[model samples]
Target: MAVGLVAVGAVVGLEAADRAFPPPLAEAGMVSAEVQDRDGRLLRAFATPDGLWRLRTQARDVDPRFVSMLLAYEDQRFYHHSGVDPRALLRAAFQALTHGRILSGGSTLSMQVARLIEPREARSLGAKLRQVLRALQIERRLSKAEILDLYLTHAPYGGNLEGVRSASLAYFGKEPRRLSLGEAALLVALPQLPERRRPDRNAKLAEAARQRVLDRAAVAAVIGAGEAERAALAPVPATRQALPTLAAHLAEAARRRAPAVMVQRTTVQAPVQARLEALAASAAAKAGPRVSVAIVMADSQSGEILAEVGSAGYLDSARSGWIDMTRVPRSPGSTLKPFIYGLAFEEGLVSQETIIEDRPADFFGYRPRNFDMRYQGDVTIRQALQLSLNVPAIRLLDAVGPSRLMVRFRRAGVRPALPAGEVPGLAIGLGGLGISLRDLVQLYAALANGGRPVQLGDGVEGEPGLVDGAPLIDPVAAWHVADILSGVLPPSGSRRSGIAYKTGTSYGYRDAWSVGYDGRMVIGVWVGRADNGAVPGITGYATAAPILFEAFAKSGVGLTPMPRAPAGAVRLAQAALPPSLRRFSAGPAGLVSARAEDAPLQIVYPPEGAKVELGTDAAGATLPLMLKLQGGRAPYRWLANGKPLTTLSRRRVNPWLPDGAGFSKLTVIDARGRAASVSVFLQE
Candidate 1:
């Protein structure tokens, strides 16, 4: 009975000790972040705390050949032994006894994992005993593969670099999944005295260590003798190469999203991203310094951001490169014209071939002009949209109402920023409001997706995607817009392709934008100063559109035909059209009775309380002082300082030659004898 009691007491004592001195490796230290592409390729890696690049690696991620060599050199009987090697221990003990000094310390891969998790500075018997105990405990709990994973994750390769993955990338600028013979041997040798034999620091010692590993590998039959000899002669790297910086902005964002997660997978395709980034970098470099570029490519069907280059260079300090341009709100120039025309189609106000007057017209005193300050007179709805005529787009926006367009954008998960205290206006069609590139992409994606634009994001089947059920415009309208855009000419030198795309330039050329989509993908491009500084001679057509075309060629994504015209869509000649559908009229006359009191004509430019400096012509010669009106009838009369300027005939946009610099009252009287006036200081 006493012997039984003693045995039970011993069992209880062991359980208590196990609980008291459990392994200190309950959690790993700050593991370096790993951002992977959709196909499971590394996009980027960030260092851990203490400035170490210790990315957690699994045994599966390592090359089989490297694993074989690692086993042969580091621990011959790793799988057979429990934690410590009895043969090695006895050999070390006998050598120490015979030589009266220690030749080698017996440490198995499992024991090394234990030491790595619970590092001991002192190289003494007590520390060795603790490592053995922890290794035995780990072996009892984890499988052989798990133990190897732990070792591979924690084993030191060189300064601030732990794990084979980190070391492989630092030295070879590639993944450890495919390593050459010399590379495999070098990786196997570095863990022991990592700093002393670091290739970047001491190439000779590193080579010698690698040769030793190769010899051992040959003897163990992990590699043939000839292969080992060839590996021994292979050169060691002299310096560590930088890890990949592709899709840097997105990688950083993913890391921030789950900072504690060792590996973060994103919905990015590495090859496509690499190509787009290269194109953007080349374009930005030729454009100028302090100019950053952003590109966003998404699947129209899925709304997944397949490739996103937030900036041309994430480390470019001169361009404020850290900022994400895709999220920044900027004026989207004529790019929104397609949607405006689509809205008009949806409203049954016009069809593709409907005759629309592109002449200068005033809207309650706000006059719109074509982009080049030249008028094309009357053109078909398709012609105006294809030409990106500002007056026609504004005329359409006026008819549809900017408020309705804003509401549609909201339904598609887009929110355009309006100027403080200002409501949506016809000017918005001319890039007066602010919209992020991503929001613009989402809206366009909706049009490409048959009027239902899902929210733009990075998601897949396992994770819920952001999808909006509401249509941005009717399916027929979206289809008409796509057909027209597809017919627009591709950028110069680019082959004809079936991509429905549009270009835009903000007022003052502060922003240039290009958005295009095939049947499958939507890509948005933005080129501008992050600080909103204007870039000279840069327009969407000249800059952003070409990039869009080149991006498609490099993207390697297959071309998808634009959606066919919906059932209700129609193209008609002016003579065959309904009278109401013949031309778009959005003035006071169109909305109000002719007998109603005529709203007083007003001047939108040369504000009564502001100063204006009319810029000179392209040749630095006399600059025409532009005169614009909003709410006046055709054949309007104007006076400058009570002096007759001219008797304007027909729908007119006239410019007055400023008489030097001084304050002047600019007045205009329409055919109805109703007048509006503004006083301003003009600089010549």
Candidate 2:
């Protein structure tokens, strides 16, 4: 009765001690932050706060053979024992006592995991007893599988690497899901003396350690002797591989967003990201030490950013590579011209063949000149855009209110940065405003997706999806712009990619940009110093366009044909165009005289048999009729009912008051006596 009472008291005391000191299970939650591709391939990983590469690992993520080998080598009775194996411990103690030295520690996998969670510097008996007690507590709280997971996650593998996954990736350059016999054995033997037998630093020791695991596995009948011999012949990796850093910038950004999440999944495709990263690095090296490159490739239909190269090299100090140029707002130069033309097309102000003057022009004190300082006398609307003429774009932007153009841009899921306290103006069409490469890509994606705007996501923020706003432009107008841009000739020595693209160069050669798209994918490239410093003689056509074409070639995505012409979209010849669309003229505010080379004279406004409204003001005086014409020889004559109402005029616009509110005929005769007449009913 006394013995039984003593035993019960000891048990009660042990239970109270266990309750007083619970295991630090929360340490298991501190794992390395990882950024993975859509398919779960690691793009980049940031170390834990303690500077350890301790990735979270699960038994299912490792090869079954490796797991079996680890169990067999570390703890033969792992499945049978709750936390400690008595038979193994007795044998170790007997051998140590008989030999007068500690030959084996008799530690189970659970004890090893406990030590990993709370490491101790001394190998004293007290430390061992503490580990054994912690192991018991761990087993009571966690299942066998969870304990194994902790071991797999916290097991040391030399240097800063902790987890089997990090070790495997570093030594073998692949995942642990599919390891060879030799590789499995090596990994099973690593955690025992990780630093002394590191494959990268001590290949001979690593090989010897692996051989011992193989020989033991054979003797234990886990593998045949013949198979062990074959596995022994396999060579150990002599060097450690640098882990994947394909999307470094994006990975860092994702970590900042969700610091607590162990693994952050992105929409990035690993293959595409790898290829573009290589391209950006190579391109930057060739460009110059100070020049940096940024590229963004996205799906127009899904709005997913397949690959985003934020800089030429994330660590290139000369190029300020840490800056994410894709998101940095800078002058876009002439890249915004297409949208201006599209707005004009949507407003029925011009057609593809409309003759628009590219001569130097002024808009409310803002004068925009051609890039070459020489203008194409009177080019078609298509030619003006294909040539990237500055004056023509400003003219179109002036006609279609700049504020309206900005509204369209907002529909495309981006708001361009305007100068402080300044309203949208014509200079914006000439690269006066700032926009990022991502914003530009989003806008072009809308153009490629038939004017339907899509909001892009880089897997870091959210899924790429369609925007709820209206289309950026009408389908017909978008098609017209695509048709014109597609006809733009490729850069010298480069083959056509069958994609619609545009190029731009900011003022002072600060930035060169190229954006292109097929039916499905859109890519934008920027070449400049990240510090916003100028690189002389750098033009978009000569520098950025080639990179754009090369990216399309190397992106590994098949070309999706541009969308077919939408309803109401047609390429009209100059002669077949509507009178208004045949020749584009700026409003009275920014109009310039038409040269003799302009299209034949014709009255654009007040189409034949149309009603004219001339409402009176508060003064009750008759308001004069405003007549507008398109092309005409200078010094034109205007007549009402065969009577000359005004002397010969050099301007295409004229005003007249009808004798009374009734049917009237108006005629315009140019210097060549070529007359075009329009009849209309007047109403007050």
Candidate 3:
């Protein structure tokens, strides 16, 4: 009797010690990284650090119907019961007495949670008592809801699948937030014998198990008899479904941003992302082998990224699809032409009606030719930009100074990549430098955003825009550019209307791009071999433009044109323009004597990126800006921005009056398209 009393005292002592020091719960807490889209829908899930595909879920992430079915099928009085059910225990005892053997295993959901947390292999009485003790201990520590959450998160579903979210994705290829009656019943039945009744392993056994749940559902009045019968007939999944893997590139980026974080919310809309991924895949297949596609869609109002597809296929080896092409630098053909024209308009150097010659021209031994090797001879500034003429754009770039354009891009948060040790040259006007699709889209978005730049991101989290700096360009210039682009012909068979778009084909056909924007959104697309090798016969107009149009169509956004013309935008004809603007008349301009061949061409007046206000004459009329000559060939053809002046003279001295306020480019082509330029701010 003394020994028995000592044993009871020892048991009490052990219980006290157990309560004083509980086992750490973190041993079972490994969870996968869950990347969600803008609406908080899971975009993709990565395995745990331990390489397990466990996505631990809370009770709220699951369908209420699923939770109810789980409780009804597993434990009827789960809410009322503690660690162990006395009524169930007594019933098991009565059945054991009648049958002279153990009949039902009377384990509450809490006891199962205990087993899951502290597993034991032996089925001995000592082990059973230990499980009961652990359950009671756990009940005292966590609330009923928390205890249920532990079960919902850790319960085995099948094959590497644990928890309802992972199982729901593996079986139904979706979240567990919403489930049909049949789906709920199957999930409820799986945890009983996860591996044994795996749908992929044995559909018959899985279906049979699911039917048993349906039978119970009818008896418990959880569902009508007809509903139960239909649920029982619902076919079980024959194989595990693939998980959500959209936005793979963004998924990796988010992971890198917060490596230790298990869940990351990114700036992407789930539906648009999914459709763009599908469209990318389709474009790749049709573009032949070794070809890949990249696309970006952003909101102009807030600069939020709606969709970004880095490649056609993340696992496609032939196309080097793992590369994030949106961030990659490639030549941006005529995509920068609109910006060039916009700057000219801001400077009042030229209006849309100012005539410019598109003939072959040379500057400092560098001759410029059109893409098709044919010249339009004479075209207005509006026509020149719309047609993307090489010579005219080069003349504008020469005057604007390529470096100045680069500075404007930087202010707008974009940087184009240039060759090592190479200076900005007139070639840059015709796709000479490299710019990423992402940066290009951001620049175009500025035009749609009324000359302001909205930082690109998912709006769930704030992405800061330009830090209180001046707008990228004058609103009137931006408006004019948008209006001109809106009139550019759309690709064949495109049903879209009113999208201001531009197409670009890089040198050697290495890259093709089509970026477009409406009043509120911008989308940029790139099609090419990710390896940077040339892909012949694929022009931006033929390949990438169509994809861009289709992407906007599938994006479910209404098409809106650019906002109304900003203040200072004037509608005038060639005859209505001022005498100085009536006809572009640029004289031969030089920084050195006409006979000085050793000196490189340079701008003498209105220095590079200089802000110059108009000087008034005796009559109070603005005096012309003096042009000095020094180097290069005589009879230089001068241009204000891209417009050819009516005069081509051997005399070095030239004159240009300020027509308005804003930025302007002044260029002088010395026989060759090889030219000298300066970007100056002209003020009235």
Candidate 4:
């Protein structure tokens, strides 16, 4: 048989010599190396041109237990045999024939190393002869320990993971020194069928293969029979090291900063990253498999992204492999509206007291509707923002003009994917433009940092810019917007408190978002399908808001109110208005009669106090106030002090004095009978 194989090889060699076939070259001193994190954590690894099939022989520092287990299970006579075991080869061939499959392999560890260093092109008689020759050549040139070291370092365990060093960390989450006898056995069994023995893929089959290793060890006298039995029966402790999604994202981000060949120091806190991953996984499990989620958390002042979850799972997973929903641009929904209204206030285009008509109106070809599909006509700019009114936002956008608004968004660090010549309509205020969740978080971070622009970084050094331009919104305007947004909590509009939040749902419910900021951090969350399918009954308020709240709560991030504007920051009054209502004025006097067509009514006294205290019923009291009128007729509803008087017959009545309990608000209805509001401070 040996002579026949040699004859066949000679014939094949002649045919191959006439062709381009080259003899596999054997080289000395070839080695592959890997870099790992402290605690034997797998950071990265590389393979040589010889490929990843060479016999791995660990350094003397490597645990002897791992080496013992490898030889005991793989080739019992590895130390004594030159390269091949003639008796074992015959037995393996017989077993293969009886099983009618390639269930057993006869290659000794040394032969495997030979094939790895000088790989065969085909699994035929000629290739086998060449492999045998090379194995003998290797045995003559290297010692037993050297051969074992080569085999240990170059074996492919599974996936991109190679070598026992990497496999030890990947599976057992421990160093070879820490591996138990059972774990050592499991690692040894993997080289035979790495895929079938993968812990994450087929844990049961892997355990069975591990048991076989212990049985073979005992039979070969490599381990005592009692020891082998105990090892075989020992429970494999569940791996404690979970692959963190956020950590993976941070690593990817770090890799971008430096090549994979270079080590990167990242700002990722393992505990924080683990918490973020847990929160995202819990949220995703509750959200169901179809809903894709992305979260980005950043430091408001430093603009460093502390945590980011690109998707629920790795991008390579079959179920979650389409688009990277986090990076893809989607309509930011109402999350972008705050910036528009914020820019308006900052630019002096509008003020909290400025009465904007919230009645339904059409712009050219687009008609915008509120989330509830209800019209709230004549709402104050403050109320418009607090309630997230659609019409008021569009009206404000109309007043600011799309061109200038887009410029403000760009300045605020929002890069909307609006096409050239695509007019920014009223819808843009309600997230008509597509933007990424990362951009949304950066924009909110800018708002939290006092209108200072944000720079998106992968925990690397970079200057934070105010989008494409200088600071667009004035500090005072940004402060006011934050102040109003902070009040939109549960029973008000959101379940999150102390957070300047905005919830948005795009048309067709393709995307839902809740982006906001507290005193120190800015958070942006997105929920939807990777395929852009609308999740039934899933709205931004229902999906994204709660996730944001839960994430902040779990992270123990408190919501401290942003600091008040500095002492010198100028607070501009309603000085800059459109020419139509610029002339309309009312003095420091309380609610006076007005017409609806003139201007929607506004209060100018008590400084339009927010969070003012008043008795539940101030039956008869004199309240100092002022009234400014915009377009509209008013048979204004009257309030005694800060309480509403049933009749407007008597403007001043002594019976309206404070009862000294709960707060009171005086609201007036226009002649059009729309709700008009005013507040006054009353000492209890």
Task: Tell me the tens digit of each residue's lDDT in model 3 across 464-497.
Answer: 3543566677798888888888888888999747
RMSD each, Å: 12.0, 7.9, 8.3, 16.2
Q: Report the lDDT tens digits of candidate 4 across residue range 296-393.
A: 77788777666667776655353273345657898888887787777666544456667766666666556778889998876667788888888777
Ranking by lDDT: 2, 1, 3, 4
What TM-score does model 1 achieve against the real structure?
A: 0.82
In angstroms, the error of model 4 at 87 is: 31
Where is the poorest 10-residue window by lDDT in model 3? 586-595
lDDT of 1: 0.81
Tens digit of lDDT per residue, candidate 1, span 161-266? 8899889989998889999899999999898889999998999999999998899989999899999888788789988988777788888777767777777787
Which candidate order results from sorting by TM-score in descending order? 2, 3, 1, 4
> In model 1, what are the clashing residue pairs, if there are any?
365-630, 365-631, 366-630
The whole-model C-alpha lDDT of candidate 2 against the native structure comes to 0.86
Compare the candidates by lDDT and give the number of the best one.
2
